[model samples]
Target: MSSAIDSKHDATHVDHAADPEKIHEQRGHQPGIFTDKDLMTNAFEAENREHEMTLWAAVKDHPMACFWAFVFCFTIVMESFDMFLNGNFVALTAFKERYGVPVAGGSKAIPTKWQSALFQSGQCGAFVGVFLAGPITNRLGYRWTTLLGLVLMNATIFISFFAQSLKVLVIGQAFEGVPWGLFIANSPAYASEVVPLVLRGACTATLQMSWSIGGIIVAAATYGYNKRTDEWAWRGPLALQWVFPLPLMVLIFFAPESPWWLVRRGRTEQALRSIKRLGRRSGNQASAEDTLAMIERTVKIETQTGGEPTLLDLVKGTDLRRTIITCLMYASQNFAGNLIANQATFFFEQAGMSTDFSFKLNLINSCLQLVANVLAWPLSGWFGRRTIFLGGLVVNITLLFILGICASITQSTATNYAQACLGVIISFVFAGTLGPISYSIIAETSSIRLRALSTGVGRAAYYVAEIPMIYLASQMLNPFGWNMAGKCGYVWGGTAVVCFVSAYFGLPELKDRSYRELDILFHRKVSARKFKSTVIDVAENE
Candidate 1:
């Protein structure tokens, strides 16, 4: 994901040692001194050895890096905007007129089965798309694959914008999922490649920030138009998806290819030039040759023995833990009560807010998420990734337990207000920490060699988790179904507690360690608590 810095650090262009950029970081051993297998063993030969740039050095260096990172992150805004709007549209009065089923008596229209299918269709596409990212990204390179996704998304949005029936809209949404799957699975990897290890936390945080920005804009749009009677109510919002993707189509074409990808493909000259461009733009102190030298050597060493890894390798030996943890981390988001966010409109409607005000509350909710992402940079770096994530888990457990209790006790105007406020609190806690920080965990944990495939596989786990939850959310929240409002909190509250336990035990602290260093730590099966203080050598020279 290192777009601007062009694979600036380690071979993968991400921080090898976790300094919070986990996607591209690589632990080093003074160049070619160790065999690929020894990449981990020799890393532990020394202790308390600092490798790479200081945080100040990373932040103060990259102006252009920031620009490119924003470009990379903005890729998801259209997707986020579309998704948020899609959910809230069901809450609209006009939406009922268009898609709702009639009740036996003279009651308000209820959401039909087709609408549930429409909501799940995108996930269906996303599931396939995320799994496809590994092969495509590895074969075509990150920039082009991303551009192809944008083109596909735009075409699908065009179909959805003027959709005439639920079938058409469902088809469009499903097609739209393909591109987003690529973005979610690969965007962090691309960002990691371009930024210095020091800036990894802030840059990767942009991935989460982008989603909130789109959600905020779309939520605001929903507030403005959900009350309208004509087709403009829905059509108008779908058109807004176009706004974010247009500039990206052109901008991505011109953006530098990831040097890590280029180097892997044997395009040494192009990789060097890309690195040079990023360094010049970002005001980086490291030379293109220095960065490219590490990249070339690292790729060469990994290739020499591994002979190009397959998906099977992700589940074998050291990477199995990485794969399992990363997958569980993505799965944990929903299990840990992110389902509340996915169906926020219905949750708000149940909590006594009008559809319009609920949408506005969603807008506010997105703003809080945005602010949380902004704060994640400093907090994820200073306090360490595990600490902040564990804190978020605790917050989730407490807030959700309180909500679960409240929902079980009563249903009234005052209670409704309390439930809504608590939902807001939980949104802040979950979105700020778990949602954004998980990218760091997935990216930082994987080895550079398997980063693309493993991340894709992990995203596959996300879709797997999403499928049942979609049905559960429908059954629990829909008027046509169970309609268990606050009581549903109890279901996911238990899941959050499970995630908190898993993370405390299984998720290690890779905060400032290189990927190579992480390899050693995981292989040695180091205790999660010991990772932060367990110093090891990461010599940049070979």
Candidate 2:
């Protein structure tokens, strides 16, 4: 094992002109006279090398890490599936017959007030759940916290499956949301921790892919059952929620706990074992040791600068800046016209599309979202997070404005179709960029000590923004309400413009940087725009 560095050493700036080879040659001549700085420098070099590794190489070296990340994040699929079902159930004929009231044309539709309540119920529960996830994960670690959520999800499904009243259904959705919050909050943090730096962006981004998968399943299931007049048309999809948690609970039990969490708890031996398990396919004990060393050093440095890990630290000093960045980064997703995608089926139905056509378009839209999410993996590697996210927002803003313009034209088949097509394009761009890159930003931005909590707070902010937006979208799309239909684009496009401006100024480029490097940058209070260019010498910093 390599010698450990003293945790209390004050960090200094590195001279960029110094050659690494010459420093190593000097160390080679020194032989047995190794210092703490030398050991720290070696750990940093190893981590940097790992960062410089290609995506394919990282996957080959850490296949188990990738597999486990997928397994844990798969919990998100269930969360998104149920959330979609909650929104789309209003579009189901049988669901409306069961729970809706008579409208002007003798057609039954869920009242706009009820629609807003149902959507906000889940967000309310998720807000509580995400805040709860922080302390629970801090105490029990990621594996057990996720296990508890999965178990609770099984019990919550019964509430939705047997719901006979609109109130009961709302309660069920809210109950189900608790576990969903736990899953969403934990997945990205777990993925970021278990994978190497090269895999971090791609792995964390998979959470969105999981979300898209769930949406696709819901779209297909709801499409298949859209014409059914029986209660099973709605109940069957609610019952499908049971299919995910049991299998995930089993798989997650055997998954390795995040070594970063283990290190934070001061369980170094367990952290080392976890790291070795994650990298077992590589068959390199030395590499495992080095990885553990890097995690410890990063954690220790954070501790030195930030002191004891507490939720309050999230709002103190430089951490406050980080907290705001994470909160707004997540909050921006909700503002970037995502509500249009979330309530697509209902929006299409109200926008003059037939029931059959609405379901079909939503299914196709779901499939496109899944494809866009998959494309995000390579795009993240190629163009980086900030560029893609900002670029995506630009496209979404333009599409939304065009959608509003289409709505202003004489209502016709062509104009309605144009608006629907525009919505689909916006969903594709969003799923590809803002949706996936936000996960990477949240994972990379927070300090390791506060990752789970920061993520919880960030995700909680998402629901905070989402709850109100869902209500507004319900009001905008409901025929009995505002009836803005496609014109709602102007409202959301304006918000997207706000998101783009904030991201332009606040979002930093984190591609190819290690967590340890990130800690140094954050601790130094580097400006957001300067993160990519700032250089640190790990030995001098230590």
Candidate 3:
């Protein structure tokens, strides 16, 4: 069955880019295979003027899908919260004394290699955890896999709170990262599976809002607690990490597993139930059965064409191209010169802003980021992903280059203040554009079976670029060290230029395509330029 389906698909498939006249001739009439209106989810979404209303309709229509999306998105929030907490804590007087060696008359402190790397241990753990997400999710399924990760996460945070020694604390932070890494890498793939295609981008990008929310919460808490040199300043936030996952664990226990995963496992009935629940029509599995059968069909066809999904597939042929784009997609998030977004508080302080003022500024920046993420929801429909992704990159390339030059002239306190404001503005534009969209891009780039695996590879947290970037970023910003302050943007500016060139030639407009259509496009090996105009009859083999 599978071999026949693949053979038939290869025979009938057409590349509109290659033979435009033929596709142009057939543009008016509906193809025989794509008869079902619901299956063309992206068409309904794009043709309608009210995509914003469509987003609400999707949530109202599938409240459980919304629930699972929100739950999955919090793992993203956990990642954001942990990142900000680590970034902010490094600037704290209490945390520094506890974890660092004294330098300049004991009035200020700088972290040793051990302390510097300890903050990064979570990223290291995240790399390992993301790599493990594929097998863990494959064996245990989404719910248990997520629950187990959360359990480990909760335990590690507890360990961080009670630690009396630096060894204990660093070890705990590293271990704590493992589970949330597992959680984040798996969460986006889960949301992509459960949500209808119409709402996939919005659901996946909701992570940015949750991420901003967590950062705001951390900034506020860290500001309040860091007044005196006490353990509560850091420990309070450490303990607060548990607040997100505990309730999430309860919620996942009640949520159905991903229907796509169920289909691949040959549990079609369970898959139907899952789809019905997500579709908000549990009493009527008619539509649910259709979607489940579609998944099963795709799996069967793919099994014949290739084999069971593997990480190795990500580095071969068409999959390798996707893996590169996704890897660079994730890299683009960091390398696109938003270092200010990562270390906003430090940048503020290094610019002569007082600690309280820095925290206040950080709070405002985070609020802007949250609002921007929310605004991005509507814009994600109004503009193609390639447009926003490149727009942000182009703007940042210019901003980072200018900002780096400004860093070189930081002799003037006034100049530092002005650039600090500029950095905030740059961050806002970034959040409003590429920051939220990257999660969706990476998840949507791969086929269903490899979604989790590809996302894992894309999110391999502790990569080579980061080691030098972190070390140099630390050296440049440390008050007692090189203190390049705002000038560090020069380094990131170069990387942003590289990212921009690759994205210009390679990034496709994947804004409003159904998963099946996307798979077909990749299967044909269409160039990025053809994506917006390409026509795919996803139901051909069905």
User: What Cα-based lDDT does every candidate model obtain?
Assistant: 0.74, 0.84, 0.74
Q: For candidate 3, write residues 1-542 as lDDT tens digits.
A: 13433343444344322332233235643344334444343222222211223566777777888778778777777877887887788778788777667676565554635535655777777878889888888778888888998888877787778988777876777888788678778878888778766577777888778878888998888888878788888888878887888888888889899988887888878887787777666435445555665576556545544667788888877778888888888877777655577778878888778878888889899899888888887787567788888888888888888887877773687777877887887788788888878878887897777877888888883344554566667777886567777777787788888988898899898866666667768878899988877665533332
| Winner by lDDT | 2
lDDT string for model 2 (1-542, tens) is: 00111111112233324554455455452332223453455466556557456788888878999999988878999878987887788899998998889988899999988888888887788899999999999999999999999999999989978988888988998998898889989999999999887788889889888888999999999999988999999998988888898888889989999999998889989998998888855567777777877787778667766655678989988889889989998999888878888899988877789988999999999999989988999887776677888999999999899889999889999888888888888889899999999999999899899998999999999998888888889999997789998999999999999998998998888876677777768767888788766665554232
lDDT tens digits, residue span 317-359, model 1: 7778889988998888778777777668778887778777788
Instruction: Tell me how candidate 2 scores on lDDT.
Output: 0.84
Candidate 2 residue 373 Cα shift, in angstroms, is 0.8
lDDT against true structure, model 3: 0.74
Look at candidate 2 and give me any clashing residue pairs: 11-541
For candidate 2, the TM-score is 0.93
lDDT of 3 at 126: 82
Model 1 regions lying over 4 Å from their true place: 1-52, 103-112, 281-286, 539-542
- 1 or 2, which is superior by lDDT? 2
